[model samples]
Every structure is written in structure tokens, then in C-alpha cells.
Target: MTPADLTCTVLGAVRRAVEEGALGGAVAVPDRVKVERPRPGGSGDYATNAALRLAREARLPAREVAEVLSAELTRHPGIAGVEITGPGFLNITLAHGSRDALVRDTLTNILTSGSGYGQGRALSGQAVELRHRAEVRAAVTADAVRRLLEAQGALVRIDAYEDEAAGPVPAPTPAPGPAPTATLAYEPSPVPAGATAHELHRRFGTDATRWALLRAAAHDRPRLDDGLLVQKESNPFFLVRYAHARSRALVRAATRLGFTAGYEEDAAALGDHPALLAALGDHPAVLASAARLRAPDRVARHLETTAEAFLGFQHTVLPVGDEKPSAAHRSRLALAEAAGTVLAGGLSLLGISAPEYL
Candidate 1:
């Protein structure tokens, strides 16, 4: 299962424990639970610290909570095993069928949703007002954040403010929905001198300019060097776009070889691409978390990680030389297509382009 799916499953286990009095009624369930890759020397496909987080409310030791939740989780059809590690971490492994199902679901969602694949309703019914300083970097950062918030179903309005004296203007209640969460005046670190909006557009063009500004956290100074414009491996911006292009290229080559993208039911037939699969599965969670945190850099970093994983796995997507096409090739091609869709969708959120030709 995807990371998001596993998170929900874990959360559900918590809820069930609470209801059944295993965790006690006083133990409150969090709105979301974080499940991530296991740490080095850790076991299982993914790990979580939910038990540790809920230990106090449950009035039990962290390991006890973990054991209780483990009982509930092991009953899940998708979960093959759940192990409690040091200090009550839940390390989970999915059933083989669940892993294959994740591949099918991830590809289907990306293909069906197209550019809207990672968009979620986590912020649905919330209204947000963002006012940024009259600086290029601030404006760009605010724009990217606006896109992320809107993608998560927030009704967002943004404008520039030249004077800090113009404090947060009281927002009018949005029509028939939840009230505004808060009015935020976002004043991110300014771009260095000579990186004016117009100059950046002229120097790096829209794609590179946005990438340079959005790749870093809002509070940090951006690197507006010529390196961002370089089309080499050293440039992360180049690597991201190039990976998308490579994914598309693989598709074209597969088409010429008289085969198209397809998902495989058997995990063994899909070969060992755990890292790539995990990256793809984590896209939705990354987008949701990025939106919640108002950090587009999280999305940017996720795209970079996904791109890196996809690039490393690209060579296997198509047959080499006269090697005949098979189900494995088709499955690999589908995975590549999903990665391309995610790269394209994320770049669009950052106000950048994922050109088919890098």
C-alpha cells in the first residue's frame, strides 16, 4: 500500500483501539499520523511513532500502546506484518498483493487525475488570505504557496503589500463555508540585489527563475547563480526536468517497440523497485504536508527525490537491444509514466514547466 494508505490504516487502528477501550477513551486520535521510510538498520517497509505520540493520553507505556495497535493492525488485509521497534515505533510491511495494488492505484490515480494527481481535500472549506511584500522572491514564494493551498482545497487570496503598516486586513467571511483560518502577511527573505522580477525573468527565464526561488525554504536566501540555468547533473533543477523528459522518452521508445504501459499484478514480475515505488506512493502525502505547512520547498524537495529515484530506475523500463518486450517492461513503463505525471504536476504547482524535452 501507499504511504498515505498506510497512514490511514494506522490511524484507523488507533481509532479502533480507542473505541474498544484498548487505548482507553481518553486517548484522542490525531487528524493524521506520519508514516515514513524506516531508518537505517530499521526493519519493515515503513515506520511510525504513533504509539509514542499517544502514550500519555493512553496512560500506558509507549510499547504497550504499540502492542495494542499492532494487534489491530495485523488484522488488516493489506498489512503482512507490524513490528514494534525501539521506544514503540511501528515498523510495517505490506502484503505482496498490497504492494502490487499500490502500483496499480498510484498509476491509475496519476493517469486519471493528470495534472491534479496530488491535489487533496485536507484543507477543504478553509479560507486563507496571504499578503506578501512587494519583492520578487516574496511574490514568487507566495504564489507557489497559494497554488499549494488551493490544491488542498483552500480558498486562497493573495496580493502584494508595499508597506508593513498595512497590517492584516480583516477578511470577510467566505460564502457558506468555514471561516478564514488566519490572515497571514508573508514576508520571505528578499532576493539578492540584481535579482529583480524582470531581471530574473530575462536572465533565467520563467522555469529556472521559479525553480531557483522555490527550491529553497522561504526564510533562506536563494541561489540565483548561472548554475540554475546549467543543463547538467550538478543542477537539481535540470535533473528534475530531465528525469521527466526521460520518462516520456521511454514511453515513446516503448510505443515504437509495439508495446504500451501496463500494470502487473505480480510483484515479483515487476522486479525490485521498492525505492521508486515508495517515492511514487509518497507523493500524495508530500503534497498534503506541503500544503498544510505552507512550504512549497517540501514539494520541490519531494520532486527532486522522486526524480532521482525515477532516473536511477529508468534504464530498466524498456528492453535493451533485441531483448523481447514482456509484461515486466510494460509494468516498468507504467511506473515511469506515473513518475512523469507526478513530476509534471509538482512543477505545475511550483509555477514551473516539465517540458517533454529538457
Candidate 2:
């Protein structure tokens, strides 16, 4: 099951607990239950503080509420065990056999949904007017805002001062001079002096330039330097794109090896790598939050997290020399591909290109 599914399972358990008088009928089910990866030294695929949240309403100790809900949750399929710890947290471990299936299904969903996977109608039926001055930074910011707003089903109209119609005025004419010979010359657009956007674009091209522009808080001045062009770990843009390209390369290599991603019993190895799973599962929430907050940097940062997780999981995805392809390898590969989809989709929202080859 995906993390979202597990959340619903926990929510249901709480509701059932309430109805069955386990926690008494006075406690109300929360509108939403937060399920997240456990902290370091915690033993679980995911954890929830539902018991803590409902403790006051139930007029019971947090641990008591956790125990009641834990009992109900442990009975559910796909959940191997549930632990109530430290004042009332539910640490849940998925059944070993279910982890592989969950990874397989997650990847399948990502592939089928393509770039539209994390899209939502949170701003549906809303009309938004984004107004900005004619400055380069403002214009670029507005464009990014337009894409993000539109992604959430908002009807966005960008009104820039530069695009407005000019009032009637006398036109200036150049002094008469000798006619010059006809010649074609390509002159690039002019950019403001000391403006990083244009300079970065000229040096690093479109994707990197846009990323540098939108990856910072809108109120903060973007750092536009050769630093962004660096092809190292310090450069998040490179890391995100490189991660995506690496995933694509793995798929190609797997195809040549006469195997494709599939579910396997031994694929439970994916569960052992919680970082990657957590990042993939959190993708939808990141996208929605970015759109709601009108901040593309959230998506950019999320891509970095996803990239790091994938890099850590990379060695496990493919076999070493002479080692034959196995079901576990295929499942791990599927997880890798899902990470790529998330990276690409998030980059698209940020108006950055996720190249198949970096």
C-alpha cells in the first residue's frame, strides 16, 4: 500500500475505535491523519500521532488511545505490525510480501499518470490575476506563478506592465543617413545590466537559468553565478536532472539485460530502503503545497531529496558483474523509475526541463 492508503487505513481504525466504544463515543475523528516516515532509530515503514491527537477528546491517556487504535490497525491487511511508543505514536511496518507489490503498483501508477500524476483541483473554479512590473525578475516570477496556478486548475491571467497598450504619443525618427547593404544578423534579446537572469541564460542555457531564477524565495535575490553551472553535489539542479537521467539509463540497461521491472517475493528489499519510499510517497503533497504557497522552490528542494534517496538506493537496483537479473533487481528498478517520474514532474512544475541525458 502507498503511504496515502496507509493513512486511510489508520483513519478508519480510529473511526472504528470510536464507534466500538474502545475510546468512547465522545472522541471525534480528526479531519486528517498525518502519516510520515519514522525518525532515525524508529522501527517502522510509517508512523502516525493519531492517538496523541485524539487523547484529549477521548478523555484518556495518549498511550491508552494508541493501544486501542493499534489493536484495530494490526488486524488490517498489509500491516504486519503496529507499535505504540513514546506517549502515543503508531509505528507501522508493512507485511514483507506487501512491500514489493506496493512499489510495483506505485511505479505503475506514476508511469500511467505521466506528468499529470500529482496534479489536483485545489484551486478549481478560481480566477487569479497575477500582476507584476516590467522588470525581468518580476516577469520571470509571474510566468512561473502562472504555470503553478494553472496546474491547480486556477484560471490565471498574467497582467504585466510591459504587455499593456501604450497611450498615443509622437514617434521618434532616426536621422537620415546612407542606406546600408542588406544583411541578416542574429541579435539576442537585451537584458538589464547586472541582471542575473539573462547572464545565466546566456551561460547555462534555459533549464539551468530558469531553475536558478525560480529556486529561490521570490523575495530573496537569486544567486546567479557559475556556481549553478557546476556539475557536482553542491548544485541541486544538476543533481535532480542527473538523477532523472540515471533512472532512464537504468531502464535501458535493464531492457538489454533481458529483464523488466516486475513484482517479486524477494523484492521486499525495497522496504529496507525507507528513504526512497518516503520521498516518492510524499511527492503529491509537495506538489500541492508548492501550488498553494505559490512557491516553486518547494518542488526544487523536493527533487533534491528524491535525488539523494535514489543515489543511496542506486547500488541496490542493479546486479554486479556476472550476477544474473532477478525479481528483486526488477522491483528495485521499478522504485528507481518511480523516483525519476517524481523528479521530472516536479521539475516541469518549476518550468525546468528534466532531460533524459544530463
Candidate 3:
């Protein structure tokens, strides 16, 4: 079993003992209980010093308290043994293969959660508005999102793209100006045609491990020129991975920030604020997304926006000094952390890598 599954059992017993007056006390220990991985060569799988911490409040010797606690733990299912050592510390060893169920459950939860498998709630369904700068990027991203949403049974309204079916649109402007103006604009609003998303996935996605294929390409697969895979093949996977990661991160950060921004649970709402280029901080991806949206591969181009937002938000430092990261800083830090988590998570669902550091 996972730590939570085991810890909850012991914690509940301890609470019950205190309530039933099994351990004489004018007061119960008002402290948090913790379970941690046992040290190397340790006799048990998980260890806790709760008994020692409660000894004073219980008006009993530490070892005596640990003995009583140990008895209480071994009575539970999924518990193989509980022992007292090191001045009344409690160590618990779980039953054989208990963690297998936990692992299975965890994987099931992850799959059910979609891109939000381990995501925090920084911003849930807060009407997040992603502004697309490149027509091609916007179109590709728009189409991708529509497909994803439709698959998820989410109602979505799609706008017709002017440059239908990757047809010739306006060339890139020599200089940046108001929004974007093509020298010669054309958006045919082409009817849905060509291979379906499923067919594309079969040809280019490679397999269910499509995103993992990105990693596999680096080692197990045969090497290619300059380590470059076909842009058409690699680019879509990248976009899917990137979006899922950012979205998951935002959800979690919103939760930590006392706001809810997840699709799973009700928590808080997010603001539709533009992640400004000036305040992007170290988030170069955000800048890239803004700049690269017009390329032929709209999915890849659209991905830059989500990724840049994630990178821009990695660490949100404030002007506050003399205090350890202010409350605002802590919340922002959570937001930033969630940003990365969501970015990575989104990418994973889309079969992409959410690199731990960058």
C-alpha cells in the first residue's frame, strides 16, 4: 500500500485510543503525524516517531508508549509488523504486495484524470483564454483543442480558419504591427477533409507510446541525421505534451493559491490574464510561442504559447525582503510550480516529455 493508505490506519487507531481514554491523558497530542520511507538497512519499510512525540502528553515512558502504539498497528490489515526502537520510534512493515494495489490504483487514477493526473488546483475552469498570435498556429491549436474537447465530451464552438487546409495565407510581415495583417489574405474555410486524427495517429503517432517514442528515439531507436526526426511526426506530439503539462500545473497551483482550477474537483477560479512578454521572466518558451504560431504546423506553433506561459511562470519572486519568500511569494511559487506541473502533464497526455528541469 502507499504511505497514505498505511499511515491513515495507524493515525486513526491513535486518535481512537486517545478518545477512548486507553492512554491516560488530560489532553491529546495536538500534532501532525508523519510517515516516511525507512532509512537504508532499517528494519521496517516506514517509520514514525509519533509515539515519542506523544509520550510527554500521555504522561508515560516513550518506550511504553511505543509498545502500546505497536500493538495497535499490527491489528490492522495490510500491516505485517510494527516494532518499537530508537527511544520509542515506531516502524511498520507492510504486507507482501500491498503496494501493487496502490500502484494499480495510482495508474488508474492517473489515466482517469487525463492531463490532470497529479495536477494541483491553481486554476480550474477559470475561463482560461489563450490568445493565438500566428494564424497557422492558432488554426492548428484550435483544431487540436476542438478534437480533444470533443473527445472528452466537452461542448466546444469552433471558428472557421481563413487559411483552410494549409492553403497559402498571408506571408509573414517584415515588421510587427497591429495584430497581424497579411499582404494578401485568404481563408477558404475548407470542409473537414483528408486523414482523420486517428489515421494521423496511426501513421505518425507510432503507438500508444507516441510521446515516449520521443524519448525512445534518443536511445533504443536507430539514429538519424542530426538526431532530427521528421518535423511532421515529432511536432504534434510535442504540442500535445506541452499543453497538458501547463494545464495540469495551473490547476494545482490554483489549488495551493486558495483558488480552484481543475477539471476534477471544485476548488477556485482562474483569471483570464494575458501572460505579458515583458513579465515572462525566464520563460523563453512563452516568447517562442508568441513568435512561432504562424508556421505550417499549427499544432507545434500553438504549443509554444502554452509552453512559454509555463516557462515564464517557473519561479515568481517578489520585491519583499527581510522575510523568507512572502505569503504572496509562497502562493506565487505554488502557482509557478503548478505551471510547470501542468505543462509537463499536458505534454504527457499528448505523448510528449515534460522535462523535470527545463
Candidate 4:
């Protein structure tokens, strides 16, 4: 199950305990339960401090409250075990096959949802007006903000001051690769360093230029150098785009081997790749925060994190040499594909390209 599902399960258990008089009805149940991946040296696939949070309201010691909730939690299916750790934290380990099942379900949802995986209506009916100076940084930042706000179902109108004397007006450079399916209204601001927009476009291309513009915080000057064009891990943009490209390459390799992605139920096959799963699960929350905070850097940073996790997991994705394709391979491929989807969606929101051949 996703962390979200586990959270609901815990909340339900708490509610049931109160109803059964196992815990006092006066206990103030929280509006939302916070479930997180356990810290280093901690037990279980997930952990929560619900017991500690509800202790005072329940009129019980934290550990005692944990024990009560743990009893109810252990009754739930797919929960292999629950341990009451230090200070009433509940560490939960899923059943033997549950991790793989959860990964499979998550990947399936990502693939089926396509670019809409993390899209939400959190800002629905909210009209956001973004006004910015016509500087390169401000224009790019505003454009990205517009996309992020729209992603969350907000109606966004971006207006820019075109005082050329204030700064160079950014020139409209065509995006790289194919035409974008959905176009946002963006008036390009002045090119950085008094260079013509065409010169910058020729130097960095659409993807790198946009990444260079949006990766840094708006208050900070972006690094607009040849370093961004490097095809190595040191470059965050390259790492993210390369990771997405690698995932696409895996799909091609798998197709030639006569198999597509299939959900697996073997826990051993899934192994210990909790980091990638966690990154995928946290994507929706990241998107929401980025939209609310008007920070495209959050999305950029998230893509980097996702890319790092995918890189660590990539070697396990497909069969190597004499190894035959197995359920594990298919499962890992699904995970990789989901990672690519998130990377592409996030890049799209930043008005950057996620090239399949990058």
C-alpha cells in the first residue's frame, strides 16, 4: 500500500478504538495521520508517531497508547508486523508480498495516468495573477509559476512589465524538439548578459536554457554556462534528462526481448528499493507544495532526487548478460517507467523538455 493508504488505515484504527471505548472518546483524533519512512537504523517500511500525538488526548502514556493502536493495526491485512519503538513510534513492515504489490500498483497508476499522475485540483477555483519585471529570470520564473499553478487547476494570468530600459526584453525562442501540445502564453524576457536570445538558444538549446533559468531560486543568479550542456551526473539537468532517456531505452530493450512490464508479487524479487518507491509516492505532495509556494526550484530539486534514486536502481531494472528476463525485471522496468513519467511531467511544468533521446 502507499503511505497515504497506510495513513488512512491508522486513522481508522484510532477511530475504532475510540468507538469501542478501548480509548477515551474524548481523545482528539487528528485530522490527518502523518506516516513516513523510518529513519536510519529504524525498523519497518514506514513509521508514525500517532501514539505520541494522541497520548495526551487519550489520557494514556505514549507507549500504552501505541500498544492499543498497534493491536488494532496488526489486525489489518498486508501488515506483516508492527513494532512500538522508542517514545511510542509505531514502525510498520508490510507483508512479504505487499511491497512488490504496492510498487506494482504505484507504477501502474503512474503509467495509466500518464502526465496527469500528480495533477490535482487543490487550487481549483483559485485565480492566481502573477506579475513580474521583464528580466530574463523574472520572465522564466513567472512562466514556470504559471504552469505550476495551472497544473493544480488554478486559473493563472501572467503579466510582465515591458520597460526595455529597465532590462533587455527576453526574445521568444522556439522550444526544442516537437511543438508543445499545450502552449502557455509567455512573453520572453531579455536574454541574459546582453546576448541575443537566438545566440543563447543556439548556445544552450531550449531544454538547457530553461533548466538553467528555472533550476535556481529566483533571487539567485542562475549559472548560464557551458557546464549545463555537459552529459554527466555533475549537471543536474543532464542527470534528470538522461535518467528519463535511460528509462525509455530500457522499455525498448525489453520490447526486443518480447516482454512488457508486468506486476510482480515476490518480495524477494522486489528486494530493498524503498528509496525509489518513496520518491515516487512523495511526488504528488511535492507538486502541491511547489504550486502553493510558487517555487519551480522545488520541482527541479525533486526531479534531481528522483533521478538519483532511479540511477541507483537502474542496474537492477533489466537482465544482464546470460540472466533471463523475470518478473523482477518487469517490475523494475515499471518502476523506472514511472520515474520517467514523473520526470517528464515535472519538466513540462517547468516549461522544459524531457527528451526520450536525450
The model with the greatest TM-score is: 1
Residue 215 alpha-carbon offset, candidate 2, angstroms: 2.5
**What would you estimate as the lDDT of candidate 1?**
0.82
RMSD of each: 4.1, 11.5, 22.8, 6.6
Q: Which has the higher lDDT value, candidate number 1 or candidate number 2?
A: 1
Among all windows of 10 consecutive residues in model 3, the one with the lowest summed lDDT is 264-273
Taking all chains together, each candidate's TM-score versus the true structure is 0.88, 0.80, 0.35, 0.80
Residue-level lDDT tens digits of model 4 in 93-150: 9986677677767778899999888888786666666676645566667778777777
lDDT tens digits, residue span 1-358, model 3: 7655666777876887787776785647444587765554456667887787888888989888788788788888778898777788788876755533443343344445544543332212212122222333233344434333322322334434444212222221122223222222222122222333344344444322233222221214312132233333234444434444444555454455455322221111112212421122212222222222211122233345545554454434232334443444443443444444434544432334464321
lDDT of each: 0.82, 0.75, 0.44, 0.79
Model 2 lDDT-worst window of ten: 164-173
Candidate 3 Cα lDDT to native: 0.44
Best-performing candidate as measured by lDDT = 1
Candidate 2 lDDT score at position 252: 87
| Of candidates 4 and 3, the better by lDDT | 4
Better TM-score candidate (3, 4): 4
